[model samples]
Every structure is written in C-alpha cells, then in structure tokens.
Target: MTWKTKVNSALEGITGYTIVRPRPQAPPPKDTPRPPADPKIDRLLRAPVFVLSPVRSGSTLLRVMLNSHSRIHAPHELHIRRIAVSLTTEPVRQAMDALGHSPSDIEHVLWDRMLHRELVASGKDIIVDKTPSNVFAHRRISTCWPDARFIFLMRHPASIAGSWHEADPQERPMEEAVRHTLQYMRYLQEARRRYDGLDLRYEALVDDPEGEMRRVCTYLGIGYEPGMIEYGRHDHGEFVKGIGDWRDKIRSGRVQRGRPLPAPEDVPEDLREVATAWGYLQES
Candidate 1:
C-alpha cells in the first residue's frame, strides 16, 4: 500500500475524526449557531498551530492574532518546520538509515543539525510555520505529530482573485483564485481522508474575526484574550517583513488592508460557486 493509504489505515483506528473539505456548510445562519466545543474533541492547550491555507488568504492576519496572545510567539511563514519534521520523524529516519548512514551521521544530518541551524538563522521560538502548501502535506504532518493543531484560513474566491490581481497584474486573476482555492480544498479533503480523528479548525477568519479567533484559540486549547482580536493594530514587523515584503504592501493600501482579501460581491455568477464552496455569501 502507498504511504498515504497506510496513513489512512492507521488513522481509521482513531475516533471523532472531522475532515472539512469544501469548508463546512456555511454554519447555519448567524443566529442558528454551531456548538463551539464538542466533548469528544481533545483540548490542545498551547499546542503549536500549523496555520495551513492558501497564500493571500488571511494567513498573515491569523498569524498576527495568535502572535498577539501573551503565550504565543508566531513568526511569519517559515516553511522549514515541515522540512525539519519530515527529515527528523522516526519513519523518515528509518528510511534514511536503511539507505545506509551511520546513526551519528543521520542524527547530525537530520533533526538537530538542520533545524538548529535554521532556528538560529531566523532567531525564533514558539514558532508557527504558516504556509498554505503545508496543507498538501497534512497527512504526513498529522502522521508525524498526531497532536499538532491546524487552522485553515479561507477567503472568498473573488477577493482572492482581486488580491492576486492587485499584487501582480500579470496572472489571470480568476483562474489563479480558483486554482488556489481548489488546492487547499483538496488538501483539506485528503487530510480528513488520511487522519481519522484529526483535530482541525477551519474558519473564514476574515468574515467573523472575533468569533473565529475565539473558536481557533479554543481548538488550540488557549483562552480567548481580547488582545487576539486587535493584532492588526500591532507592529509585527519583526516577523512580518520577511514574507513577500508584505509589510510594505500593507502600508500602501489606504483602507484597512489586512491579509485576507475582502469578501467579493463582484465575482461573476459562473465563478460564484467557487466562492460559495470557499465559505462566503454568494455574489449575486
């Protein structure tokens, strides 16, 4: 069986799995309200969150909020964590050993060596690797660290398209947006397929900032502090400046230009389904 299948098989043994592909149906109307917590769900107190979602999809916004919490110190999108985990995990280590490397060499070449080098290079801890592509490897990641928490950030496709167009006018905006949304969608689906009882929270953080942040922290097993709601007001330049010169970009916009593209109302009808699946009110 393929590694993915094996992982899926292993996950089947666990109960209370929640795979959210295509985003959970727009939580009943605002008043209907979904249950905030389930007894079966394991509380992940202060567990590091691997914020996985598409780029330009409010990821930075979510990261900044978590960073604002006194207990959290999230850096910008540092992809090296997944790489570190992949190279150091026991199964991966065994594969390397089978390929003929001394234990000392493997230890030096794998975990301690590269991770320490990168951590020092960046100078951060309580690290959060916020990469959209990380979702692509969620199965491996969940298998590697079963208790790890995930928060998937989603944005309306039209807004995602607009943001992409604003960032670089070269690409076909609509196409890029659809492609981006689908990539994360498939990852969410696959993660559910592979990890039976994975603890993941998916939110359209841009839509309901306060409510989502509360649920996100709850899933992370952290208390809901008011500070998390105003992270955008803080100066996150220390870690924010590193990703795509985003600090400069955020400074350029006249309006409140947070990471997530605003909900799109101008999206063409043909493409409205994409936004709907992405968890946004349909554009008429």
Candidate 2:
C-alpha cells in the first residue's frame, strides 16, 4: 500500500474516526430564463422605483431628498440582487419544480417580498431603491417587477471617475477608478437606451434642488413638498460605508453644489463617447 494510505489508516485507528472530505459542488447555472411575471403570483410591491446610475453620481443625495417626502421611503442601497436562494436538497428542488417555479422565479418572489416588507414597515406609499449596481441587472430587475419604474441619473463621466478616486485615493487609484467606473457608466447607458425613464443630471440637481425635486415628484405622480429640498432635516437611515455614501458631505444636511465639471479638453479619451452621448461633451 502507498505510504500516505498507511499513514491515514494509522491515524484513523488512533483517532477512531476517518477523515471525511466534502463533495465538490457545481456552480449554479446563470442567466436562467425567468418566466414573465404573473400578477396572480408575482410582486407584493406595486410600481417600485429603481434609480440607475454609476457610483459617485450623487444617488445618495437624491435618495435622501426623496426620503424626506412624507409619502416616499427611499432607503439606502438594498442590494437585494445579491440575496440568493439555494435548493439544498433534491426534494426541495422537486417541490419548487412541481409548483412551476424555476430557480430564478423563486428568487424573484424572495426579492419582491423583502422590498414589500421594507415598504410596509416604513408606512410609505412609494419605495425607491437606489442601488447603483442595479444598472448591471437592469434587465433582470425589469423582469422581476414588470410594473417597476426607473430613474436614470447621469453625471459628467470624468467627474464621476474623479470623485470615485477621491473617495479613497489609496484604495482607488486614478487608472483603476476610470476603468471600474466606466463599467457602470456603460451599463447605465445601455439601460437608459432601452428603458423609458426620467433622466436627471447631478450638476442640475445641486444647481436647482427645488426645481429638480419638483420634476421628480411630478413624475412619481405626487405633489412637490418643500421638505424634499430640505433633506437634512429628516432621518434617512445611516450613511454607512457599504450601504451608501458615508462621507461628511452627505451628512451636512443641505444640498451642496457638485464639483465643477472637467474641461472638455481634459475629458479622458475613454470616457469621451459616453460623455458626448450624455450631453456633457460635443462630438468633434
């Protein structure tokens, strides 16, 4: 017998137990075709709002303003997409299949129930989820909540890169910031092209908070409230790191103007196309 085998046998005899290695598990399938939502079995929340934007685009600011309204509850980044359901046993899988529920369908139900619970707890008529990464899963979100509404938030691409780097200079260098932030920009642009939603710019938001907020209220089919412009007066949960912007600027209570846009010539070549498409740059 092999030396390793003899050693293992000896250890088993001395210890009175054999080593048990876990079986390898296959990775779950991705992009499983989700059946269309059926009102009879689908969403618990009606017409939920999703704000799609790149990181450092002032979504936290918008969320706070929306939260200030009496009838609206704009919670911090609830990355519900990351919350997954696993079928741990054959019987569990068989039971779900018997109910005509695909793996994705079960996940959809879980996502909806969680959001609806949050909404009910807050006692708000509308719930807005402003997770920036939601742009990457925009199609899946649409499929999950067929009656969902979208709000596309835009910013100058160079400014977004600069802000992302500034948020943590040591952890997020300029080169990496540009590359990482660009991914979100591309996905957000794709969603904007495909979905019909209200578009708001960060620059415009800070420049005229009242006007922009009024427009948002109108779109959501609610009357504009003065409290929305004074977002600092209300409690908008915590400004924690992972959940949303945790910077002092967000904690300041009132709307502050955004940084000046980078010069057209200073815009990076990589971001020029998206900038031009977003109206921050003119095509040469």
Candidate 3:
C-alpha cells in the first residue's frame, strides 16, 4: 500500500470523516453576532495571516476550524509568500507601471490584492492562509506586514513521513521524513525567534479541539466560538482535493479525533532542540 494509504487508513480507523470535495454551495450565513472589537484586534484583522507548516500536516483541517469563526476567513493554500519569493525587481517595477515601490512593497501588493478579493467575496475581514509552503515566504511576508501572524501547525514526524511516501511511494521514506521534518523545524525555530504567534501541535488539536482552538483564539485576540470545532460539517467553501488521501477525513465536514498511531523513532540528536521545542520530543 502507498504510504499515503497507511496514514489515511490509520486515521480512518479511529473516527470516520470521509472525503467530501468542495462543490457549489449556497453562501455561508453571516448571522453570528460580533462582540466588541479591541483596537488591538482591529489592527490584527487588518493584517494577513500565514499558516505555515509542511504538507499533509493537517493545515487544511486547521484552516477549516479557524474559518468557522465569525470573522476569520481561513482558506485553502494560496501560497502568497511563494509569489513574493519568485518576484524580480524588473517585473515588479513593470507591474506597478513605473510607480516606485520596494521589492517588499511589491510583494505586499500581491498578497494584499489576493487577500482583499478573497475576504471581500467571503464578507469576512480576516484572511488566514494554510499554505504549508508559506514557510518559504515567511521572511518576505513579515517584511511586508510586520504585524502579520505566523501559526506553525505540527503533526508527528512518523505520520508526516508516512503520508509523504504514500503520496509518492518511490522516494526514500527516511530521507524525506528527516529532510522535511528538519526543514519545517528550522522555520519554526526561526519564527519563534523572530515573530509573536502560536505554535500548535496537530496531536493537541485532535485531542482537545475546543481547548486548543480556545488558546488560538486567545492568541489571535478573539473570543472562542464553539462553531470552530464543528467546522467539518459547515460549508465554509468548496472543499479542496489535494494530492494523496490525507485530507479526505476533514472533508467529511466534522472533526474526527483519531486514535494515536505508532510514532517513528525520536528525532535524531542534532535536531532534537527544535523537535523538543515544537513538543515532538522529550529528549534526544
């Protein structure tokens, strides 16, 4: 079986959320009353959010949960930061019709425009993007929006690696796991060093979504809403069908708390600092 199958099978065994693709649906009702907004929260809502993580680490699931909130527009991967990284001076200048803008400003324009459109269409003010590749663009995103929030979502190394191999079983499983896990850890470490945001573990989320999401709402300066846990059942947007089967369960429109599967060997000694920092290890 594909490594993806292993991950899907294990997750499916515990709770049964099946894959439901995003189809055309009526508008999501906006009847949730808004509480008084803090000026601090007002500022935060104006800034974009980059939900960073490696692929198949449950970022999509997190996005839907956050989107269940009254104001937050947590959408599927848009990879805005990736666009920032790919920009060149000349193209940016040309796009601006000779208007003066720093490279950072140009990238910000790109991010802002896309987010503005999405938020407008959704009738929500805040935009949360769950692009695992956004870690690549974190620096530029921060440069553009100094107050931007970075949420690092983490799953166990074993599950992440197993899922990776299942997506494409031809690759060397150990190398893929070690390389991607360490890379994600590096970004998480740097983000902790540089930014003020939350570091949430996937395990914690599945274990106690209410408590974990409450903590997240606190971090984001928003009140906790019980709707966040029932995100899977609501129609936030068209469901995203991604590579492999890891995301199918969340598409079932309800969060299913999965039973713990066997964990891979602890992270290697050299990388244990970050692994431990992210709550993935106790010791080297």
Candidate 4:
C-alpha cells in the first residue's frame, strides 16, 4: 500500500472509532398523530347542566342532591379540565406519545378506563361534573361546546377563603391565597358578564342545602328528590365529608385550616364587605 494510503486508512479508522454510528438511525418516526377527540365527550354526554364553581363552594352537596333525582347523574370531580378541551384535539397517537405509551397498548388502558368510568357513573342525560377547578377552563369549554348549560356556584368570598385555609392549612399564604381567591371570583363574574342567559346561580348551599338543592333542581328543569338531603348518611367512600373539612377548620379557629382563621366579624374590612355582599355574616 502507498504510504499516503496507509495514513488515510489510519485517519479513517480513528474517525469511524470516534464517531460511533448513532445506533442504526431508527426510521424517522412517522408523524404519529392523535386520533380525533370524541365529540360525545365534549358535550358532556349531552347533559343539560354543567356545574362550575371554585373549590369548597358546597358543590359536593349540590352534586349529591342532583343525583337524588333518578334522571340526574352527579359524578365526582370528572377532571374534564384536562380532557374536555386541552386534550380533545390531541390525536390518539399523540396522546399516547405524550403519555409515553403505544396508542393501542393495553397496559396504558387505565386512562380511558378511569375516564369512562366517571363518565358512565354520571348516569343521566343531565350529568353534573362537580369539578371546582373547571372554572379556569370555562372559556375553553364554551368554545368546545357552546350549547352546554353552565351552572356556576358562588360562595361568600370570606367563607370561600376560610374554607380553603381550613381544608389545607398550607393553602394559605395571605397574599397568594387572597389573590387567587379574588382571581377566581373575578373569573366567575366575568363569565356571568360575558355570557348572555348564563345559568349562573349564587348560594351558600351548605347553609341551607335542602332549600338550595330544590332551587338548583328547579333551575335545571329537573324533578327534586328528598334523598339528596341525606347524602352524607350514605357510604360515599373517600367523598364522605365532601368539602365539610371546613366545619372543623371553622370550629377550630385556625386562620386558614390549620392556622388561625379570622372570625367573620374579625375579617379585614375590605374582605368583610365582599363577604357581606355575598350574604355571609359572623356567627353572632
């Protein structure tokens, strides 16, 4: 071999050794797209009423009462916020890719299984999805299913903040909690302002559940049932207390949940005004 040929071979050998082939370039993965989002899911199974509220706003009690009517199915928090709009257009393949699984894999089947379970549990034509956080996605839902009726639950601002603090002591940060509470309140108000003929209802359901539930059923154009009054008496598993942790929190006098909660009279003047507007008063 020529001297130059040997040098070139040596250089090539070094290059090949150093630049390890990127393990047989896998065929450029075809653009695996997600399957179309099911339209049925978007319309909430064609349910007439869709409840939207902030957390701990007596929605659970509302849900139970709604379910008491044979024609109504009030499922626990459906968490439709992620699925209703955000993931609706995602292709099945893309969804699986996002979930790190094959689109048709049986192992990752739990996603649909659980989601469908909740969907199926909402037994009536009027399925009530009692997710409080869904307030954030109201506009998105409007875009996705404009015909769906939205029933918004509004609580007294002070009690709402107090309920948050009571449920999770860590939920309080003074400024942050206050800001979030105000933001949520504003969001609900904006929904009411923007949507014409919106089925928004305001009530402290916990205070007079029987009366409130009857009104709710009446608004939704559904029959009322007395069974709703005793939802807590049933074996609801994890949802037993529903959002009643606040009762203890309020009784304990922790500002938030575990912290020191202010009395209705003791609430800051500004917050107190907000609470009063919503019909909440201190227990005299």
Residue 218 C-alpha lDDT in model 2: 91
TM-scores of the candidates are: 0.57, 0.90, 0.72, 0.60
All-Cα superposition RMSD per candidate:
17.5, 4.3, 19.5, 9.5
lDDT of each residue in 235-278, candidate 3, tens digit only: 76676455212456866877777547544354445455655676
Candidate 3 lDDT at 56 equals 66
Q: CA lDDT of 157 in candidate 2? A: 99
Report the lDDT tens digits of candidate 2 across residue range 1-284. 99978888888887568777679977556547474557665778888999999999999999999999999999999999998888887788779889888788888998989999999999998999999999999999998887789999999999999999988899999989999999999999999999889999999999999999999999999999999988889998789999999999999999999888899999988999999999999888
Q: Which ten residues in a row have the lowest lDDT in candidate 1?
A: 27-36
- Highest TM-score, which number? 2
Off by over 4 Å in 4: 1-44, 84-123, 196-204, 233-237, 240-284
Error of 1 at 185 (Å): 3.6
**Model 4 Cα lDDT, one tens digit per residue, 176-243:** 55666766766766676666533433353545656766777777787777777666543333443443
What's the lDDT of the predicted structure labeled candidate 2?
0.91
Question: Candidate 2 has which clashing residue pairs, if any?
Answer: none
Task: Tell me how far the alpha carbon of residue 23 in candidate 2 is from the true structure, in angstroms, after superposition.
Answer: 9.8
lDDT by residue (tens digit), candidate 1, 1-284:
89977777767767976433354434221121111133133222223457666666667666677767765666666564344222435576568558754343332234233433544454444446577777776754553344456665555555555665566566656666556556665675456445443232323454466777788667656788887777766556554444623655344321243444444556655446655655565435
- Comparison by TM-score, 1 against 4, better one: 4
lDDT, model 2, position 202 = 96
How good is model 4 by TM-score?
0.60
Off by over 4 Å in 2: 1-31, 35-37
Q: How many angstroms is residue 255 displaced in model 3 relative to the true structure, after the best TM-score fit? A: 1.7
